[model samples]
Target: MADITVKVLEPAVSYDLLTLDELKTILGISTTDTSEDALLEMWIDQYSDVIATMCNRVFAREKVQETWRGDLPPQDCARVFLTHYPVVDADIESVTCNGATITDYEIENRSGKLTLFGSWSEPIVVVYSGGYLLPDEAPAALKTATGILVTGARSEMSRSTISGIKSISHRESRVQFFDESGGSSSGAGAIAAAGDTVNALLYKYMRFYV
Candidate 1:
């Protein structure tokens, strides 16, 4: 038998595997839609219950495809079920955008219920200005860009932020996250472009609570 190639499904990286057109086809939607993000939204709108049933969690891309429903192809059906993931806001004690908009990112799963395994030992905040990044990647960027160089394990100061989060205030939105407390009242801080620029450099904040 000839060996077949199997592409990996890294739901964390949206570019892999399926496109919006693939998802649309699975949901029986028009491919003409300009925005792929919008098409995913449509899937949630029409099949909320079905999607919920598939929210089950798995460790690997192959595992995600393994949970596909009977009606659709493994990739297409799993992609539909794989479109969104729920954030257990309970784990999120307090969030500071640092001027970045707080938006929900959904990951679709076609399995059963999902339990996001992690330790709620402490509350953590992450900052991102460039292209979207994984949770682990965001914290590193936030630390370096905030003039707070930290590495290895938790440091003396980094350990403290977990306790006095709101106490550490921002003067103005440095990283385009106007919704963040650090933004300037004159409102230049509120500008996404300005904030993102400030966010790219350490001139933005004293430290981010990543």
Candidate 2:
């Protein structure tokens, strides 16, 4: 295994996994209610980013260039995993190593794994377009999870003033809030300690990577 860095060449036009209308429907807010549109939009963006972070993958399709650095083990030559999954074979523009294009490679469309044939060099770079189309094309469960997350955040905000709350906790359930320094009091722990339903919806999509 090696260190992988992904750089977006053309960022997705929108990172929204759930649309404004969809969110409004979840919240039971009328489509004509313009009073809270700004606030709602902010929450939508924040929560969408949070969901992606939690899943360790973006749901919006974008062009990207990924680079691999450091030494790779012998077994790694046969298979290298890409950061983003569900890659379409046609979306892979190129895979290069040592400044030359690699033609003897097979792409695992859904898993984002690349099987390289014969000898391979270090510092492999892969250029590809992956991820869901988003909002409209996002998985149904992901959209449901987004709605749950936003609704939970809204409910928490309505309960008390933000300045007075350090973290969210109820009974045995707890979710730590990051301080001004962007570090949580819990040190290394889950960013979201959502309810059982929310957790269940997100469990399958969760990715644990180095």
Best by lDDT: 2
Where does candidate 2 have its weakest 10-residue lDDT segment?
186-195
Error of 2 at 176 (Å): 31
Model 1 lDDT-worst window of ten: 145-154
lDDT of 2 at 147: 89
Which lDDT tens digits does candidate 1 get at residues 79-143? 12221222232322222222332233222222212222222111112221121232222233332
Residue-by-residue lDDT tens digits, candidate 2, 12-125: 888888899999999999989888888888988998898888788877888999988775556446567777677988999998887888989899887788888877777789
Clashes (candidate 1) = 23
Off by over 4 Å in 2: 71-77, 161-193
Kindly report which residue stretches of model 1 are placed more than 4 angstroms away from their true locations once superposed: 1-11, 14-18, 35-39, 42-55, 59-210
lDDT of 2 at 139: 84
Alpha-carbon RMSD, each predicted model = 23.8, 9.0
For candidate 1, the C-alpha RMSD (Å) to the true structure equals: 23.8
Instruction: Please give the CA lDDT of all the candidate structures.
Output: 0.28, 0.79
Output the lDDT of residue 12, model 1: 40
CA lDDT for candidate 1: 0.28
